[model samples]
Target: MTEREHSTVVGQLPRTDVSSPLTPAMLTRLVWALWMASLGLLAVGATWTGPGVAVDGLTVLMWVVVTFFSGIVHSYSRRYMAGSDHLGRFFYRLFAFTLVVMTLVAADHVALFALAWLGMGLVMADLIGIVRGWPQARAAGALARRYFVASGALLGAVLALLAWATGETTISGIGAQADALSIPVWAVAVGGLILVAMAQSALLPFHAWLLSSMTAPTPASALMHAGFVNAGGILLLRFAPLVTLDAMAMQILVVVGAISALGGKLLKTVQTDIKRQLGCSTVGQMGFMIMQAGLGFFGAAITHLILHGFFKAYQFLSVGDEIERTQPTTDHESSSMGVAGAVTTGLTALAGGAVFVALTDKGTHFGSGLVLVALVVLTTLHAVRSVVGAASVPAAVRFVAVPLVAVTAIAGYGLAYRAVDVALADLPVVTAPADLTIVHGLVLAAFLAAYLAIERGVYERSEWLYVTLLNATQPDPETLLTSQEEYNEY
Candidate 1:
């Protein structure tokens, strides 16, 4: 061999390392097969039940379509497909559309119940599989994925056994013997499945796995966070009538949703990474969905799910655009707000929260008085901030608006002599006129604060919360299809 050629060969050898074989085609086929099987099951389910024919048919159809979309996602596991971000986006919308269909069809007891058990278990397992096999997935993430798969599989098997033991493979007739059996068998199945699904959805306490799952690819993150993650809540909406059976469970869902929404918003305030912020926001939003389910606001929850899925998908897709723009650049983190603006916002938030807390147990006189005081302070500070910061808008403003309105309305209602139930219809009027006035004023102030935050290059606290909501249960984008040397296949 020539000396120069030998030298070149030796130099190249140190730069290369062996890697796990690329098996995108295999992954694609598996996902495709699973999608087809889910559709087949839906078809079987539709025909197996003789009654509620229309409901069953629609439910089956929706499930089939969603599964197909999920399969398409898996199909794009190939390296060549990774280059086409648009294909990834199309799958995202399909997944979202599936959620919308499921939400609408789940209103039927049988369909809701069947989907809760069979469909949720399958979907969770699918997500776990994809996350586990991701080429660059972390050890902890892979372990978490396996745990989800095991748990989901175990749950599915248990339900299947329960159905068998009762001599009822279909959800329509399993509980027909007992007095309580007057409730459709679907309700029992749906209830059981919804509980498990909520845990998988990461409503609050079961939320750690969701944050960890963020280490996955961005397309995976987009689909899961924007659409797939909400599958549990949608499942719950299907069995809305049954969720009321156990009052404690209903209350728990409500409280979890409340905590997730409020606490998640607070935490999002501090996150530095883009993905983590969105993940936390997702946790909060799902909490809202759960709360709606608890309140028997099935319709509202479904609507929220649809709107959120669309917007969040758009937001995640934009992340890829941001990545491409930033890739060739250096650090560009914006500076924090000036001291005065920060202090004003902090004090306003504290006062708002304090008033709401203080009034929860108090009578009309004290509650109204406190609410009025808090509202005035909040409004004044908000105005001051807006007037001063009209020239330096931040990019995060758009994301934060949704949560700000929600929190403001919640806090406003809490501080008044009114109950702040999530079911929009159930929200009562304020007995105290002062409290009502304060609520109106606070709403205006919230809008002002949001505007000011945007103008001052400051991310509104709610925007941060939204980011957390998006982050909490969503996947990270960078790990999805990067060409960076550090992430490149060997």
Candidate 2:
């Protein structure tokens, strides 16, 4: 060999023994073959006779596409870093694994979902341990450690509780209908686990983790918040039969899901940062799915789960461009927008809390008087917050005046509907569920308005944080690059 070639070989990083493990080509070919096999079966199954087969088969196909794309991206990322140091190699491996597991999850096949979940959990735990063992003062490492620890702890507690509950018949049998016989312990446990995970997926009160986890890079956030986060809601829908068995749990699921759905929508409207907006939107979308499940609309929930996953993944990708456009340009970064314009932007928040309370307590029923009062009060408070918190005059007017105008119009319309029904009624059917439901539906429409307002506020706060806070809170250099352009630009 030439002297220069010998020097180059000797100077390479110490951990350059790429030959010990399976070769890249071998791994790639193996994964590619499996992916193709899954896709082929999915296509065949899609045309099968049964309704359930069509749904399940299509689900399988969807996941195959997700995984196939994820694998391709991972491969590209890996090859780009192939000649880098040991640390680069390690990260590429992790990124690739996360993508593959996420793709497996999207497929929505029960067996594959379980296998991928367990495998990913183990991978995350191992990564955390490895980082902790290293002497590096890495903030990203520290954040990852916290994430894995919290995630594992939460999952462990639920699993243990489930195991104990499964051993006892009392929890399992309590929800059995009078006509039906014993229910499976595993079924109950699975429902409970999914519910807990769904909550932790950061819907409403559990949302702190989504913001905190921003310490991670955009890609990780994209995968976790935009993609995998949807799993919790889907998981619950998968166990809809078991969830319905427990009436109290079912009600809680419905109410909480409703609140989360509205809350998430209200939060997303005003956000400045692209990722945070997407994160809050995910929360809302998941809430909607959970609501469908709670209402015994399992088919709809599954449909939503599949659709939202695709849309959210696309949104996350688009957000990268938005983030790039707003990024600081120098040591003293120029602002993305002028202060006057920023101040003038009015957003409606608190709309969710108000609208949610209103619909639940609409007083359409004889016994719901107190519920109505509570809802009215909550709505008033929302009006107060909107007026007081308004960034501009038009915003304040819309927040306060719009709802008042809406409520007045709804009550008047309801009275008119009732009067007309009564005036025409002595003849045929005076009272019907359809008529009442129609009134209730109108009331529900008002609540939807309020939900939009609340989401606007949430989006604003998120935008503020993303634009200002995230920029200010520089990540630790040991684990993250100073500029996204250096590592992320394709």
Candidate 3:
């Protein structure tokens, strides 16, 4: 068969017919209803506070985000996977994973939370390898299963340690007694939680699973990237009290986050596949979220995750369009700005920074807040430059559009930050800004140097550096397909 014919056959359902009452289309509507209900609950300020189950601002926010993304993925999958095999099983597992994540966020009891966390990983692994005949899909699922199991084990150990030390079975109870815990106990617990976060978020060494998971269907990838990967930041935010106990632990988070962010970004530049590039991008974005938590702004971390979830979900769902758009472009187009364009970009960035500070009240204080503000400003600068340097646009139009877009984008971010900050105000250690240290300066310097190197194409010139990054970004060989013949079920 021709390549096109083979792909068509691979996408076809098995010859043996299977029936189910609950179709993917039905599930899509149900998920959308649930999403709407979550929004209504948030609107009415409904909450439940208890020992075994609790629903507060964080829970409500996550509920809305989770259900919304789940709804979108389900809706997309209905058409995307129409002729594929085991359509019913796929939706079932997807819905189960969504519920598991929702339960995890609302769980107050240590056992319940742990079980939900484990369930999430298991269901996601199942979804990753839903096509039973595909060797690549099975391998990807197995690889991811290992990482998820390791993450769950670490989280379980930490939760057990905290319960043993505090004599509390509930998360709130443990937090209330966090201050009384000894240094050694605090150190071990914080260390374990960080490891759990790292694995779940696919940071650095743990990122291979995500890169190899492209064998899964697009909807599964969308849900995994949009909702599942954000679990690390959610984990850290939920345990903010315990994490903030050790200043040294917080500093360690900063260092680790910086490394992961820079490493992920560098790896993304070398990836030729769209899905792997997105996986690397998630690692970098998660690093920034963790860094926000380390800076004692858990609220900001929450904001970052929510926004990232929406953005990534859309990106994944629109992958077809992305492929079509990029297929015709073989050469890289360099963007440049004249003196007027440069001036416009600089002024727009400054205006964006001012708006951000005015709305969020950041950068006024010393410490990591200043660093966060600078990063935001730099992001604005990059965005404005992209707009102003567009070769097809008229200079007058580019200059006119730069400030408007920058201010609007920054203003939206500021609003989101404020909303999240307000929602999490009642939570302990949610916005505790840490004092600046020499260690932070060193990390910042290293990040800046790496950023400059990438922007200047230093890695492209250095064969060793290019090779290192290429190897670092590659998926596991076991999860790769050598040919269409190897992809038994596509």
Candidate 4:
């Protein structure tokens, strides 16, 4: 290697040395200690069996998820960023972000929660800026910081409204204070919280940060892609009842979320780089989660958040194994099905979903059952297509396997629903208003229209639209994709 190139990579990293105090082992020891403290608190919350500091099912689940995610990413980063000059400092920043996430979820007082929320943004600014030697990384960090400010502002508005309406400074009390508030105050608070949720989660216009985040190490990306990025959905779930009470908030959440989901997913299809693709996918998934939350399907949204977080984290950490995971041969031949497999797949999915819904319907309204059914069918179809796509099974075996897979899937879903149901029972069952039902259809139509436009080259018809989207991701992903050796693989 050339001297200049070696120095370039080293210069791009933070100035730190491997030492006893700065070792990855030492860094993570303290990190794990704090995380274990949270687990102890979790046990206490469970035993209290009464009003406590963010001790409900949702908080407990999130606390555990984030702590474990931190540990996994910490261990992964030990090797992933081992060669970097800033290895020690990187852990410091990453640990700070993870710690802030834990505190935010566990915060009981309104002020403390808000403070923790602000602290997350501050720490993330440092975490994302770890590669300051790269101008592209700096730009991405600045862009993310601006959005973080916007989110903090919105959160501030929400807290002000909450305090004004109920004279309560604790999160638990504010949730309970919902019944005492005037309609106007409640509406304003809910709206603010929705926007805060969107901004924090990088929905659409605020999403360039995720792409820019690729400039950081893969381990930090895993920490983010897995658990940190879901903060918005988590926040919405934290305030699910408030979200459902305001008709305007619900409408805005569904409409904007649908747009983000469609746009983000479409963008993912066009991206060549893995990190950019994953970032776009996260945006779409977060939007879908927001939509689920808006529809008052908090259980499904929480499930989606937890499941997607871990899956994405695995993807980030396993970047070196991508060829094996999606190689389309051997075990990865899932997406290579022919026409017959496709047809059978559709039929099996439909039948399986119908049976699942029929057998498990607890008289759920607002189409919650439909949501669960659609997701189950889609998940089942994908699995069936993958295995059947392998084309190794006899026709008779394939036919019989369909029923077995369907039954197993429904049973698995039943377990998931029960888990989410129990965890979120502390939060009320929120449903969308009847008047907002039409908005749902319009949102879906918009999503379809977007798909068709992108698929049909409608954007190409307009020079500016094409150019804008082509260069849509900010901090110029081109620099990160090319012209930079340090993060190219990432």
TM-score of each: 0.50, 0.52, 0.93, 0.81
Those runs of model 4 whose alpha carbons end farther than 4 Å from true positions after fitting are 1-17, 20-22, 29-52, 323-342, 355-368, 375-414, 428-436, 444-469, 473-482, 485-490
- Clash count per candidate: 20, 13, 0, 0
Q: What's the TM for model 1?
A: 0.50
Give RMSD (Å) of candidate 2 vs. truth.
Answer: 14.0
Cα deviation at 387, candidate 3, in Å, is 3.3
Ten contiguous residues minimizing lDDT sum, candidate 4:
2-11
Higher-scoring candidate on TM-score, 1 or 2: 2
Which structure among the candidates has the greatest lDDT?
3
Q: Which candidate tops TM-score? A: 3
lDDT for 228 in candidate 2 is 56
Candidate 3 residue-wise lDDT, 1-490, digit = tens? 2122222222344333655578777788888888999999888878888769989888888899999999988877866777666788898998888889989999999999999998899899999988878887889899989888878888898999999999999998899999999989999998999999988988877889888888889899999999898999988988888898878888988888888888888999998898888999999988888888898888888999999999999998877655532235566565778888888887887888889889988878887787778678766876777778887787677988667977898899999999988777666668878898897888778777886687678989999999999999888898888887666535
lDDT of 2 at 452: 57
TM-score of 2: 0.52
Error of 3 at 441 (Å): 2.0
Q: TM-score of the candidate numbered 4? A: 0.81
The digit string of per-residue lDDT tens for model 1 on 401-458 reads 4225434753654533232222222211111112223433443355456445545545
| 293: Cα error in model 2, Å | 2.1
Cα lDDT listed for each candidate: 0.49, 0.46, 0.85, 0.70
